[model samples]
Target: MLVAAAVCPSPPLLVPEVAAGAAPELDRARAACFDAVAVLAAARPDRLLLVGTAPEAESGDYPAGSAGSFRGFGVALDVRLGGGEPGPRELPPSLTVGAWLLERTHWQAAPPTARALPDTLPPGDCLAAGRELAAGDERLALLVLGDGSACRSAKAPGAWDERAEPFDAAVAGALGTADGPALAALDPVLARQLHVAGRAGWQLLAGAAEGADLAGRLLYDEAPYGVGYLAATWS
Candidate 1:
């Protein structure tokens, strides 16, 4: 089976050093960041594609537009199996599938240097690009890293905060489609765990380690951020 993985790292909106006298827990935050990474890798997907914003230092180097601000922070990985493709009707693994799709499918603003990287495409343009890249490559699976903005925008009809209801709708829509099963690594506090079950649909798998309240608060209070992974299918 084809598998993919995506990792989204959520650093506090403001840098720890910048928050004057605010006793922010850098160690805890960093641990959380790495934990997200670990979770994505564990899913063991076949194909992985990474997406996200420029690193903190890189973000500082470029002017707002020059750097892809819209893109959140994360990573993706794609894996191929047996040097062949899976049947069109086969289903991919669960785990971080939805999160991976959300991240890779969306584009973010980034600095010039980072933009030069192969994966630095705009989220708005990625679906077409991804379709092209996957053309004639049916065996390939996709993993994406998203910050929850683009997905929200895709679903929102009017002027809604990209971070609000629309984001939820997009997840629901993807679940409804035949893309693959999706699982969201959501904070229970932020939202309920969404499970998209269908042939190629996706599910939302919340991270048990991150406790629902804290995760929920993080999603609601802070911008949405998290890592995702796609699991490898066993033939």
Candidate 2:
């Protein structure tokens, strides 16, 4: 069963080395992410599973200790899913961010197992995957990573769109309250058009926590660099 969960944005900028001088801008988001991970640790789960957005071809399961690097972003930093023998699997950017979070927190409760899912994945499939993952005796904790709409301003990655603000606001509200149904109900087409990479990941989390009676607390919600980044904890 899902005992706890942490929701975070997947931008590579979360890493100081990647963000360079702009790192200070995300200090609060980073702090919130750490706090959310602290909550996961407090849950004392027997296992930790990380889910994140990735390219369709890259979407798949990654074993503990799978490696990822920020070399593509001109950073020399390397990260692994958890403490274990290094594997040949290379994590996509989103999982790379998740691995960085786990490393930052020094997750000691359990070695993390990870999955990367494409943003275009159907909601039903995401839910089914979550249910399958949660159908076990082990106490499971999740670290979900993906970004929301990236079209908040003209300079945004997706450029300005009138619908972006409302879409992101709804996402922020759902995440803040842990409204599973609401997350599951997001419009895939609209989300995709708005460049909301986190939609599928959030739906997966909703499915995992289908009947869980955890309370939620929104730690951070902001659109820095015209991208929506959120941090929240459910426990």
lDDT of each: 0.27, 0.91
Q: 96-142, model 1: which lDDT tens digit per residue?
A: 22222223333221111111112232332333343443345333333
TM-score, predicted candidate 1 vs. hidden true structure = 0.31
Question: Candidate 2 regions off by >4 Å?
Answer: none
> Which regions in candidate 1 have their CA more than 4 angstroms from the true location?
7-33, 43-48, 53-125, 132-145, 149-163, 166-235
Question: Candidate 2 residues 98-162, lDDT tens each?
Answer: 89988998888888889999889999998998888788778999999989899999999999998
lDDT of 1: 0.27
RMSD of each candidate relative to the true structure: 15.3, 0.9
